[model samples]
Target: SNIDFNPVEDEDSSRILFEIKCHFNLVSEKNNDEYKLENRKLRFVYLSKLNDEVTDDKKLLDEIEKFYDNQGYPEDMNTFIEYMPQDSYTNCKILILRFHEFLNLEGEQLRLI
Candidate 1:
């Protein structure tokens, strides 16, 4: 999992550019069938407008890093995003899910969505 919480704000306003590129699996836990456990690259992009109180983006990054470091990063999204010959897949089938579509979902709903 990689995080790019760089502060990129114009002179007009403060906007922190937070971007994280990580792996997410589309396979749901609710599926009791054979698990497809090999999607290593699900790229999710998220953009948001931060509040004005967020002046220091780097500090925010550090704080976030520390928090994640202590509590561990989010792991429910890890999935295979690409097909490589080494993975032993007979076909080239890649599944990708947009983060926006699953943003409002929670728990089992999020996984199923």
Candidate 2:
């Protein structure tokens, strides 16, 4: 999603200049079988500022790593979070979530929307 900030409002009021993309996976199970299916990946780029007195990059990265590690995925699964500086006037931060592996589930637990 492409977002634009408006100067008319005192509060954070930004406009999305472009389309937004989102991705999620689906799982299904048959009588005695289980399956994992992959879905299209999404990329979201946004501009936001870090909280006050939080300028330590290592601490921020470590926190994100710890959070992903505690998510309890299989050993072979991989997850990563990266932060980089941008040229925007306001303090901006970009977050990327990538799901590379699928989890196994029972058929009854699968809900189709």
Candidate 3:
């Protein structure tokens, strides 16, 4: 025996599936506020590895120079990474500060994990 599917139903389901896929891609591509906050934190850690002292400000200011000397990161991207903090915060303070900074930079934006 042969089975046949309804053309209209198949078309509708296909459209829905396509829409779902597009929505998922959109969510994945855009950096949510939380993700951006996390990125900042990671950036701090990366900077710390480059510095003699692990303070955020010092690391931030010196990262690009270190990277340039080390030839690790592209030179053009240096300016984007050049904000140095005056002092280092404890881990908890760092988290809070990061969250606060994130909120200020991206007010009330929802980010996808």
Q: Estimate each model's TM-score.
A: 0.22, 0.22, 0.26
lDDT of each: 0.28, 0.26, 0.40
Kindly report which residue stretches of model 1 are placed more than 4 angstroms away from their true locations once superposed: 1-54, 76-113
Give the higher-lDDT candidate: 2 or 3.
3
Model 3 per-residue lDDT tens digits across residues 8-113: 2334534544454465454542245544344344434333343323346544344434543443354333333333332453443454355346434433242332
Models, CA RMSD each:
15.9, 15.5, 18.1
State the lDDT of candidate 2 residue by residue for 33-67, as single tens digits.
21122111111111112112234555544443443
Number of the top TM-score candidate: 3
Instruction: Tell me how far the alpha carbon of residue 40 in candidate 3 is from the true structure, in angstroms, after superposition.
Output: 0.5
TM-score of 1: 0.22
Q: Which candidate is the best by lDDT?
A: 3
Candidate 1, residues 1-113: lDDT per residue as tens digits? 64445433332111111111112332443241222222111112122221122345544334333322332344432222121123344222221222222333332342564
Top-down lDDT ranking: 3, 1, 2
How far out, in Å, is residue 98 in model 2? 11
| Model 3 spans with C-alpha error above 4 angstroms | 1-26, 53-113
Q: Which one wins by lDDT: 1 or 2?
A: 1
Q: Residue 80 error for model 2, in Å?
A: 3.6
